[model samples]
Target chain A: MNAIIQTNELTKTVKGKTIVKNVNLIVKKGEIYGLLGPNGAGKTTIMKMLTGLIIPTSGEIMLFGKKLAETSKEGLKRVGSIIEYPIFYDHLTAMENLRIHCEYLGFYDKRAMIQALDMVQLKGIGDKKVKDFSLGMKQRLGIARAAITKPELIVLDEPTNGLDPIGIKDMRDLIRTLNKEYGITFLLSSHILGEIEQVADRIGVIRNGQLADEVSLSDIRRQRTDYIELLTSNVQRSAFLLEHELQVSNLKIVKDNRIRIYDAGISAGQISKLLISQDIEIEEIQKHTSTLEDYFYHQIQGGDKVD
Target chain B: MIKLIELEWRKLDRKKVFGEVIIYWVILMFLPVFFLKVVFADNPAVHFGESYGAAIDLMLPIQMGFLLFGASLINHVFIEEYKNKTMALSFGYPLSRKRLVMVKVLFIALAVFFCSLISFVLAGITTYGLDQALEVIDGSPSAADLMTYVVRMIIHSFATALASLIPLFLFGIWKRAVIPTVVCAIFLMQFPNFLGLLRITLNPDLFYAILSFLGVASVYLSVKLVNRLGDL
Candidate 1:
């Protein structure tokens, strides 16, 4: 598959402080690419640079295989974006706002506008002024304007921000439908792990203005580790007993008097019984299955390179 | 470019712009007669009451009020967009920021020029009509007086349109200060009067030409430096 978006050493500096450092990212066409990072991690800044809202200090963005810059922005016509939040001429009605957007893009289709509003579930509110809209409604309206062009790519920054559960679900579904049905690629940024986990085909972990790693969701799932964890003050004796008696040799001790047993054929019940019979005090014990949350946590906290 | 200028107009609040234009028209239309009948009635140094030709002199300076109208547009088209982040939307478009700023400047200049020209005609008609009924000034308007008014109306309207943009670069786009933009307009409108009050003897044409040049320079700088100054 061809790359829809590529950034080479993308960096942005403001007021002599580096906001986004040397970062390289690639987003393939026809896939939902998620940028997972904490707040102020330069996700919006990167999106802004890609969308031509701001110029980068050092780096180049290739959109649709063309250089994205202050002057060479023809590729932006095929991209729709809402960097931080939805912005509109609050005094204008929703229809007027969308109309202005289409006119700028030189794309005019009244029926398509209606369909976009319908897709975002903002059909009947087209005639209403944007100032009267709730935050959720405004977000939906922003989505409507973005998808109204049916561009090749849509970049949404925290698309679920200020949305109810149903609205968030609707947004997620809308993104999926647009991707699946229309083949519109997406670059979505969010701090919520579950939100991205549900929608993103691939996730890029950004930490402190750096691209830590980019991996497919399936790859993370395949590498999911299942382990048995126990907290005991008498760590050395438990380690000895578990290895000598239970033949559990694949165990490792962690901080805070805790041990993680990765040995197969081991159960929390059997481990608890063994520890109790041995007169060893067990503070806590549980069988664990690592999730995307754990993967994301490790990626962010440890900045480890995952294969 | 015209399409982009039209888009700028579409982005604005039409009703509010219409209301503002109407207020400017009505006040400017009556200001010439108001000064002649009330403010300058007893003053001897002010000779706007001597004849229709003299009243044209007073009317020309009075029409500088359109500079304030230009300032208002700079607020609507430029400063307000910057404040509300709609400018970010425009930046996201395929067009460059320099082109966008150029279109906005052209829109403001064209709107101010036409509106000022219309205000001059309305003020001329209203002053003449009121003079016929109230006998505010000394003789009737001559063919020469009418000819001069028609020519100066066009020239001064164009000058006022450009002069109104004097603060656009510094106050409107750079500082994004609304109060300073309006204050700058007020100062530009009263600039000739300030020279008179200070006993300056500079020619009127020279002074207006200078103001108009400053407006053009401001516009040129705005378009040239927008890429750096236009960041949100």
Candidate 2:
């Protein structure tokens, strides 16, 4: 795939503290790339720099094969973004806000406004003030505004931050539609792992202020393995016995009474025998698969500061 | 640039800020005329000597106040955009930061001008009507003097309006929207007293010249400051 956005040694500093540091990112064209990180992890800061809302202290950003500079109007014209919370004039109607966006883009498409509103399921809220909108509705309106100009790339920072379950589903479906139907590439950041996993083709995990890892969702699933969770009355004793007697080195002690063995080769009967030999009674033993959330925490603990 | 201005106008219009503009015009126009007619209706001769010029002079301070208010209004526009996070959407557009600021300034300037003009015309009509009722002019007053005063009031109002833009722009960049508005209000209230002190301490003619020069200088400085601040 062709690269839609490329950053080299991208860094941003506020006061004496660094917000983003020496980070490089590559977002391919026509793909949904999710930036996953917790709040204050510099995800929004990176988006702000990418959208030109704030200047990077150092480094280079190339959008659509052109470096972003003071005169990089053409590159920006092809991009639309919401840095953090999507903000709009509360008194203005959704359509009115989208109209303003279109005007600024020099796009006078009369149909684009209605079409975008329809796409976001806000077609019926033409005249309702945005202040009266639900959080989900406002988020949809923000998405509509970004898509109204038919920008080549859309950067959304925590788009599903305040959404409910159904709202998240709708947003996920809308994002998929935009990417699949319109072929619009997206760079979205969210702490919601499930939501990101649902639509993102590739994921970039940001920890601290730096990019920890950029892995394709498919590859992550392929490489991720299931582990056996061994619950014993005395986890410490069972863990010690499993490692020493059974020679299982991949023991993860989760809680006071539970130990997870990552080695799939070790059988439950062998684990029980090993625990019994140590006078540790097994309460329950089951297999547990590693999830995206587990991977996220593991990556975070790995000292990945994408600042 | 025109497109950017149009976009700003559309956004303002959608928010019913245009309606607020109309309300401001009506208040500015009717309040002075209503008061002048009610207070001096019984004695027309002494009160009517160049009442138009007097009215125009009266508008100088009011226009100054309005201009200050207008500056605050400009700051509010950006502040609201910032608070709502809509500012990023605007900055994300293809336009340069310079063009964006220019368009916003132009939009507010036009709104101020239009409202001031409406008020001025309404005041003129009120003055003309009163003069007709009293037969004070023997006919309509010479169009030259009326036009002169109208032009002066417009210029004064415009200058005062532009002057307010400077501090508002600075405050909007430095602080938030309310800061500039409050500061402008306080300055407007104290400006007359400040001028009185200047007149007493220095040559009155020189003071006025300096004040006029400062007004012009403030406008230039504001434009420069805004450009330098770039996208916030």
Candidate 3:
């Protein structure tokens, strides 16, 4: 897989406090990579470093297979981003803001600007000054500005932030369309699991300023922990009966009170019946299938801040 | 660099700036004559002596008025951008922060410089036109008086342009405080008046040289330390 962005131990420390630890992230070409973490989890810091908004303390950033730094930012022209928030000269109209952004990249296309606005469903509202825009409208216009040049990659930090449900859905669809149709790679960060789950092909889970997991959604789905948890007063006896009498080897006693059976061939009813026959009290039996949220939670809980 | 300057211009509120500059021009142009004719007419204690030379000298101190305009540009270009988080947008662009800051300083310098030069012309014309009607002076402007006016126009305008940037390093870029930046300009403009209160006489040439030095040093430090201080 070709990586559009690769960071080697990219770290940032501000005011004697490390905000982002050694985070080695990879976003492949033509893929939507989502960065998931809680608030103050260094998600924005990482994004800021990636977009050259903040300098890294000790690390290397490779974009388009080229190193990115303060002195060498030529690769940034082919990149677009809106970090933290959608900032604009509030006094200027949406179209003027987009035009100034384009001039920076040396990408001048009036029609493309209008087309990008149209894509965000902001067609005729380009004449409206940004100061008069609501948060959602500003977010939509920000996306329009980011997508105007149709660059190779766009890094968006909380793109759907401050949007309604319909706006969120539109943002998701826009990301998917840009990825699939234009082949524009995206590195987006959001704390909303459902948002990432809907649009991201892969995810990099950040916990305490460190990347705890970088896995494809398919891999997460395949690795989903599905098991039947049987709670009982006597877990040792229940485990003994399941292992010896029922010949169920794929089971483990958990928390000194429950046994989790991973072997799906044996039903929860069958396990309960065997435990009951053995005079072991079966308090509860539940089949658990971990969703993305649960997986994210487990990942975060499993990983702590890098020392 | 020119493109970057153009971007800065587009980023600002042109209408507000133009309107503000027009007001400054109109007010400063009429001020010299107003003070000479009405405020300090033949006042014995004030001792302006009712001369055209004194009126011209008064223009030099107030021409530093553009320093306030400099503060305005700094507010728009530096402080407001930081407050609004728009500086991060510029940082995310392809250009280096140093180059971006250089453009901002140049924009402010150019705007201040040209505005001051134009202000000199307007004030000169207004003072001359009012003097002709009132005949406040004994005779018409001498060849040497015209020479002084021309020379002051060039030096004083240049000094005003540079003086306007006096706050760029301290109040404009470092403190990022709007009120301090404007107050700094006001204090710089009132330096001679403050000296007058203490009965200290300073040479005008030396004062202008110091202001010009401040402008150059401010621009140098701004570009020099952009990497250290330009972070969002």
Which one is best on DockQ? 1
lDDT values, one for every candidate = 0.92, 0.73, 0.87
TM-score of chain A of 3: 0.87
Q: Which docking band does candidate 2 fall into?
A: medium
Docking class of 3: medium
For candidate 3, write residues A1-307 as lDDT tens digits.
6989999998888888888899999999999999999999999999888888999999999999999999999888888888888999999999999999999998899999999999999999999999999999999999999889999999999998899999999999999999999999999999999999988999999988988888899787787768999988888878888888878879887798978998868888898788777787888999988788888887888843221
Better of 1 and 2 by DockQ: 1
List of clashing residue pairs for candidate 3: none
Supply the global lDDT for candidate 1: 0.92
Task: Order candidates by lDDT, high to low.
Answer: 1, 3, 2
Question: What TM-score would candidate 3 get against the native?
Answer: 0.91
Query: Rank by DockQ, descending?
Result: 1, 3, 2
Better of 2 and 3 by lDDT: 3
lDDT tens digits, residues A158-261, model 1? 99999999999999999999999999999999999999999999999888888888999889888877899999999999999999988997999997699999
Task: Score residue A264 of candidate 3 by CA lDDT.
Answer: 67
B6 in model 1: Cα distance from truth in Å? 1.3
